[model samples]
Target: MEDKKRVGIWIRVSTDMQVKDDSPEHHERRARYYVESRDWQVEEVYRLEAVSGKTVMNHPEAQRMLQDLRSGRITGLVFSKLARLARSTKELLEFAEIFRREGADLVSLAEQIDTSTPAGRLFFTIVAAMAEWEREEISSRVAASVPIRAKMGKPLGGQASFGYKWHDKNIVIDEKEAPVRKLMYEIFLDCQRKKTTAERLNDLGHRTRNGSRFSDTTVDRLLRDTTAKGQRLANHTKSVGEGKQWITKPQQEWVIVPCAAIISVELWEKCNAILEEQLSKRARKGRISEYLLAGYVKCTCGTSMYVFSTAKKFTCKNCKNNVKVADMDEIYQQVLKGYLNDIEPKMYVEELEKAIAEKEYLLTTSTKKRAQLRKKMDDLVPLRVSGDLDKEHFAAIYQPIVAQVHQLDKSIPELQAQIDFERIQLNSTDHVLKEAKGLYESWTKMLFPEKRAIIETITEYITVGQDTIDVGILHLSPSSKLTSQHQFMGSWKLPT
Candidate 1:
């Protein structure tokens, strides 16, 4: 009598509807039945409830199952489908490699992919390649549309620059922030110092859009941005690699859209020239890592907190409230862990997928309808030429067909553009999910720059109060109206 094969079940459903309709228990039961048919003993079940399939390798349940497979606790993993295992081709390949190295098998019931056999292995490879190809096609389409959208002055994706707002697809100078932005240039010209300008702005009670005090870095960035001089540059930067580090695109590829200038071009040049001269005079030093929460930390008194050169604490100049640097960092790390854990990727992914599907369906039907109309128009043209139809009859029938075809011609591209936008959004969500997975576990090992990038991407602002700390997290979806705030007790005493 041969010993039965041991396998672990993997279950991940991404939405409440999925949980209700195609429940994890149902998936597990089906997998168990499949395992019974193969005489495989079910050893463990790994459930990733409401978790995304974007990147599961770093997920806790995924790690547990991988551990079992490696340790010979289970000889195989059975999931409902390949997507339930992972949507990312790279991750799917990684899982396959691990399974091969560990002498284990992967069985996805939906695709009938059983890696215990040579044919199954080949099938898995083909499917993974197809998935990769599909992802690349979507990405290519989105990238191609970007320049077209940018050239047309369409609001690409992100928020407009600090002093401007996007209204009705047009960039306009913000009424309240415009004066403050213009004042930044004037102050910089008079003082010739970014720090002094920031100090003056803070003194005058001018805060950033998030209501945080301006820093020298913020002042420098605002002054250097060409948007203030009327030419708002778009498609000038691209995110590179897994870290999503942004790098400048070539100048030739940049699309410059003219907008209302916040300040005179002469004044902008003069301020920038002074900055250039100062930069040239200064000794070039290695870039220093800024505080983890620089411009983000705010006081309850509605003032921004700063860490001075002589102090080891974040202090509010207005209220003199302070917390030790180490303590604040520890608190932030804890808050970050909670925030990442609470994120529900399904909610955002579901909405994007729904929108994309609707647009794609509309595009397909419209395209077919347009073809039919064009054929009718073409058939009428021949009849009119042969005198089978009178001129008035041809005009009545052919003109309506031409108009319908024309309307679809206009609408099809719009539908595709909308689909492209949703695809881009879905890609972005996947990137965020991948970055977030195992972030808390790997936080301590990350470099200063990497940690800073995550903070800037996810955090809106952090408020330090006398008895509490409030962290305002940025929305996962652009359309999300919900603001996430995590409050922690400030029981830790400040230094005397």
Candidate 2:
């Protein structure tokens, strides 16, 4: 084991690792010095560039080194600094354990530490903690910076998205994609007229970026997205829960560069409003019955019970339960009305309005922070002229601070756009509530079969128990599995 000639060299560079100065050359020279002093023959040097030192697993070079260790090919691993290998103490200890188990040594030239020593392990614990802190500080510093550039209508990311071209200061609209965007709006109108949807367009044959056939999801994204018109997407809020993701309509969150506008803002808003209106109507009317939750309810078998009536028998084909259509319909209607009465939609709207106002308040705080960061960065200009602070420190402090200002710059505008989006939704929700209020009275007067159609449109699935029923209403639009269905619990025995 002592006579083993296999050796591994791992090299990593964050953006600053390689400089015009002797920093990188010094790192290489020191590494080579140790290799020459010891008779360890050069096997493989894994060099990773433009990567961060914050994550040990993510770095390509580190991954390669670990792979060689697992393969029993590496007798030893060498780095200049412990930070070059890991950012966290926990991760450093993991590597230490791996090397110890493999009968291999982990050594750093700068720290003069090796895994063979108990002292080296202690040194690593301290180095890893510092590295972790530095990584987190850099992250917060970056988060504080991006909005300023976005606010100025400057291109922050490397390139533009699908429908726009990146210019020096702003993104120009791509004329070719703009027409296809307009077509998306027209298609939604056609769907309303035919009482059909873009789902057919997908089935017929259309392919998107992934080479998969077009789906209703693709059409839905196009209709809801504001970006296709060469405008920024509004209220692009992202939330992750239970390892699931949800991306909603582009609320009013946008940084519209006057120079970047390709489609009129009015036109963009009009397209979305039209599409939303048509979808809501279709989802309610399109279902077979007014059972609001028709598609939503699942049988014990996990299959959906079909909402169908043949002659006087209402049956779940999967469950084989023959129910009276009139009785089931009445039960579903009563369940829905009961749940709506509990909600007090008007009160819900008021709560949402207050929440939006708080976000707008945060926007002001963000704007003030940006002003401070910008003013501080400007004060550094005099230091740059007089040489009080050298150019290097100036850049280190100023560059990151400037990025902070840019990020702050975009935050408030994005928040304001969100407030606008929520306002629109609040209004729509109020209107929808008004519509829901009349449902019970309207349902009683309609024909049993006609009422059935209305029930299926609003209800996703109708689940019947011995003396109880679960009616799920399709609160969201129809042509979408994206609809919101509120489950209404009710007993067939009416309240005295």
- TM-scores, all candidates, are 0.42, 0.33
Off by over 4 Å in 2: 1-311, 316-320, 386-397, 409-421, 445-457, 474-496
- lDDT score at residue 235, model 2, on the 0-100 scale: 26
Per-candidate Cα lDDT values, in order, are 0.79, 0.59
Expressed as tens digits, the lDDT of each residue in 58-108 for candidate 2 is 565677788888797877876667787776766776676567656677767
TM-score of candidate 1 to 2 decimals: 0.42
Model 1: residues >4 Å from true position, as ranges? 1-290, 309-311, 481-484, 494-496
Which structure among the candidates has the greatest lDDT? 1
Model 1: clashing residue pairs?
none
**lDDT (10s digit) by residue, model 1, range 187-212:** 99999999999999999999999999
- Candidate 2 has what TM-score? 0.33
Error of 1 at 355 (Å): 2.6
lDDT of candidate 1 vs native? Answer: 0.79
lDDT over C-alpha atoms for residue 457 of model 2: 53
